[model samples]
Target: MAGNSWILHRNSSVNFEKIGDSAHTMLIADASEPYEVFGSTTNWRDPELARNTGPQSFGNCFPGETFVLLADGRVIQVPLVENERWKLLRGREELRPDPLATQRPDTPWELGDRPYVPRPRQQSGNRNR
Candidate 1:
């Protein structure tokens, strides 16, 4: 059980832009301790890859859902669909055109097409002048 768990680390350098009410962003999902490996933006079901390669590897453990903790302190449970498994990757490559001249597979969900505007910063500091 513990061996299959992973820690989802948010990339502090990147600011998450909001769309509507939720922010669907990329997170670095790393396996714990002994299995400490880079698991983000990868296909967990790849035959040539190891089982500990990505968070999706433990999909069977949760039945049909994968839980995610948002930056706003909200936890979400996303369903694990066979065809949408790769959508969990959310790599930057999904935004820009692939330099390798390869075509990316089409997904049912909109990828990199959403208008994610950065949230306006609230004004703070001295105001009682």
Candidate 2:
């Protein structure tokens, strides 16, 4: 697992305003905080891309990738979801763009043909705070 995670703050240095003007707001998100997407907007984007990339994203993770929140808080990536803790990272009671879809665990937990393998979760307190 990559001990260094990139945690994205709500107000980061990313050119989100510019990015938003182009592709439907490329969201920088926190794995631990589902509500915190980058670009100062709700998750609004090309459903096809989101769903397609979903296979590789912790937000849209498959059955076996560990999702970790970056300590910097700018970004998150799939690690080794093989462990049991990754399931906790999965969306549960988090708010949703589509309540119908988010409500179903079966919908999100479905295995993808090409799965993502994020770095393993960092050991607690392994980094210099």
Candidate 3:
């Protein structure tokens, strides 16, 4: 993941500002190497393009779910879901998929077809800070 990036839901018609408490956010640690973002807002025009790339785990991700990509390769999903959490994995350890989640296709976005993109920072004043 790119250092401090934002991602939008692929199928979402509504923007982040309109969404409320229903959003579940999470912080995923990048215990290892950095991940290349596929659909950053500045680079990608269509959010759905990412649905073809990346890990299958992201394929089932919902569109309303906003992902915050960290510089350390960590990822954060907003609005935590019930009984669901992102655990920090150790070296060489693999993440097993949840059978329950696999069965549900309600994820708002798909990140399996394209690479994840880094959301460009908003321009504040004239400094871009």
Each model's TM-score?
0.31, 0.23, 0.21
Query: How do the residues 18-87 of candidate 2 rate in per-residue lDDT, one tens digit apiece?
Result: 2232221223322321222233222222111222133223333232333344223434444453334333
Give the whole-model CA lDDT for all candidates, comma-separated: 0.31, 0.28, 0.28
Off by over 4 Å in 1: 1-12, 17-22, 26-60, 82-129
Can you write out model 3's per-residue Cα lDDT over 6-114, one digit (the tens) per residue?
1222232433333222223222212111123344331211211232134322212233343544323455553323113322211111122223322323333447896
| Candidate 3 ranges beyond 4 A from true positions | 2-7, 22-54, 58-83, 86-129
Task: List, residue by residue over 65-108, the lDDT tens digit for candidate 1.
Answer: 44544344564565555325335334333232222322223432
RMSD, every candidate, angstroms: 19.0, 14.6, 15.4
By lDDT, rank the candidates, best first: 1, 2, 3
Candidate achieving higher TM-score, 2 or 3? 2
lDDT of 3: 0.28
